[model samples]
Target: MSTLTLEVVAIDDGVPGIRTLTLASPDRAVLPSFTPGSHIVIQCADGANAYSLTGETTSPREYVVSVLECPQGRGGSRWIHRDLTIGSVIVAHRPRSAFAPVLRASRHLLIAAGIGITPMVSHLRSARRWGRDVRLLYVHRKGRGAYVDEIATLTDSASFFTDRTAFVSELSLELASQPFGTHVYVCGPSQFIDDVVTAATALGWPPSRIHVEHFGGDLAPGDPFEVELSCSGDVFTVESGVSLLESLTARGHAIPNLCHQGVCGECRVPVRAGSVVHRDLYLSDDERRDSMMACVSRGSGRLELEL
Candidate 1:
């Protein structure tokens, strides 16, 4: 995959922990176009952390991404907040989409929990432009704690600032009453996503119609495992200290991997042998049956994958 090493032209504080970084375009032609809910891997002081593009990627002029400073985890978002500055050069991979909004659905029910609002904000914007009916249910601890203003702009948007109980009840009722063509997107903390998924499933919503995206929190990294590539006939021994993307890149095998945390799903490959320990927030059961994301996930044992 082609990458653009663009300079950070401008940076602005969007909210308390969020900042918007405007990247200078590398090329003067039509920029890489991405749909709503698309993300690009930005190389920062702390490796690569994927950020969803807030604005539309229409021209070759600029790109905007809102980064919520993460104090914990691996310091990726914190590095962007503290270290990244105007005129600082950073390698940015072309836009990738693992959480794109499903356009086939006539109606969309967007549920965002805290920082997860970033991707859904973009989806809401695109949906509004297309004249599609969208209802945003933003769940937050307090009205001031979340990106409430951003969510308020969308049509039929509701907020639950008190607790999860009220949010789940309202979400269940809203989803149950909606037509069958409605698509539901839930993104936030792992537990929150799980709760929303469980509730929606209990309401008889199709699992395929529910999409989710997770960023951080006690995501226990799995043990390193060995992998054998079927096409290249190459074997790789991923050490415990490194990820599969890093391990493969250290060797001669250049697998296109961006956002090493597995959110972008760029390094997904067909699984031919052995069981894989899936770690990504995306990917359905059908996708897991044939493929595995090589970045975050590791093999249970010796595995064979299509290179």
Candidate 2:
């Protein structure tokens, strides 16, 4: 991915734990345009972190992103909240979209929780401009909604829920009322996504009509395992607290990688033989049969790779 050195133009608190930042070119150049659900990888002091763009898509001059301070996280969010400031220059990759609206759908349903509401902002804006039928269900803590007021202006069909039971009840009703050809987009914690998907499927929503994006959580290291390269005939033992990608790279193996959180499919390699514990959201069933994302996926005892 190409990098752009942009300056933070503005910063404001979206909620107690979330802060919204506006970034622009230093020389006032028109920045690259992005569609709804697009995200850019920001190079932070600790590591690269991806944030969804939540600004105007048409004739965009700046990219707006919201970051939630994760004190217990991998230090990326903490750096953003504590060190990054207005007028500070930061490097970021060009915007890319893995989750986007299906324009052919008759209607749209957006579900978000906590920081996941970032992308919904962009989706709601575009939906309003196109006059598409859209509804938003924003679930957050009582006072932790990031952009509740701004989102309210985009659509009157929006609803907020704080309790888990109430959220599920409303979600079931919402899914049941939607007509055919309605696309559902969900982004949030793992449990939240799983619950929403389970309810949607039980309500007769097909997997094809359901879209999802994971706001990744910290990946705890798995048990130690050994990996053997098929061609090179070299074996390496991956420690219990280390990732397969990190272990390989430390041993001088050049593995292509980005978004180490497994959202981006940059470090996927062919698995000749192994029982892989797949953790990535990028790969499909067919792909998982032979390949694995080296950055996050791990093996049980031994893994033979074609790389």
Candidate 3:
């Protein structure tokens, strides 16, 4: 993946603990065009965090990303909130999309859970620009959901439900009103995506129409596994409870990784030989047959990587 240098122009608090970062690129050159549900990975002082593109194409050079202060895990969010300042130069990747809007559908139903609102925010903008009918259902824990007012101002009809039961009922009605071709985009935690998929599948929505994006919190670093680097012809033993990427980096091997949570697919490597116990959420079953996400996945016993 190609890396671009960006300068922080401004950072503002959109809601409590959530800040929107405005980045400025050189030459007044425009960034890449991204679909409604696209997200860009930004490298912060500590680590990397993936944020959905909230800025419009007309303002391409000024990329907007919202960060929610995390109390646990890596320092990606907290550093952005506390340490990031104007004139700070950071490395980032251009917009890459996984949960793009389904163009074939005339009507759309967007579901966002908690911080999952990031990607859905861009979808609303794209849908509105194209004049596609859209509705947003935002579900959040009590006192945790942020930016409800901002979302309501931009969407056609926006509703919030703190209670899971009420939220599911309203979501079911929305799901029922639309026909089979309607597109459903789900974003949030693993449980949120799992629940939405289960409910949508039960409601007769095709599996192909439901797209999901995970916002961190995935597999626990598994037991140390063995990896045979095909290119260098060397075997490395990853320590227990350490990610394969970390193990490789600790041994002075150069490899790339972004969202270690398995969503970004930046650290994916091909398997040359041996079996791998795949754990990433991005890859489908068929894709896992020959590849593995080194960031969050581990080998079954010993595996060979094309590296």
lDDT of 1 by residue, 1-307 (tens): 4687777888878467778888876553456787788777777665677777777645546777887776866777888898888988888778876777787997888888777777887787787778888888887655324446655675555555458788778877887898879999888776777788888888888877988776633244556688898987888788774677777777776788656677656788788989887767446668999888777777887889887
lDDT of 3 by residue, 23-92 (tens): 8785557777777777777776656667787777554778888888887858888888888888888888
lDDT for each residue of candidate 2 in 1-307, tens digit (9 for 90 to 100) = 3788899999998489898899999997888887788888888876678899999986678999999999998788888899888999999888877677898999999999899999899999999999999999988999998888998898999999899788888888998999889999999886778789899999889988988887755455668999999989999899987899998899798999876876567899899998997767567668899999888889999999997
Quote each prediction's TM-score: 0.76, 0.83, 0.77
lDDT of each: 0.75, 0.86, 0.78
Clashing pairs in 3: none
Could you tell me the C-alpha RMSD of candidate 2 in Å? 4.1
What is the lDDT for 4 in model 2?
85
Worst 10 residues of 3 by lDDT: 214-223
Judged by whole-model lDDT over C-alpha atoms, candidate 1 comes out at 0.75
> Predicted candidate 1: what Cα RMSD to the true structure?
5.0
Every candidate's CA RMSD: 5.0, 4.1, 4.7
Task: lDDT winner between 1 and 3, please give it.
Answer: 3
Clashes of each: 0, 0, 0
- Return the TM-score for candidate 2, rounded to 2 decimals: 0.83
lDDT of candidate 2? 0.86
State residue 293's C-alpha deviation in candidate 1, in Å.
1.6
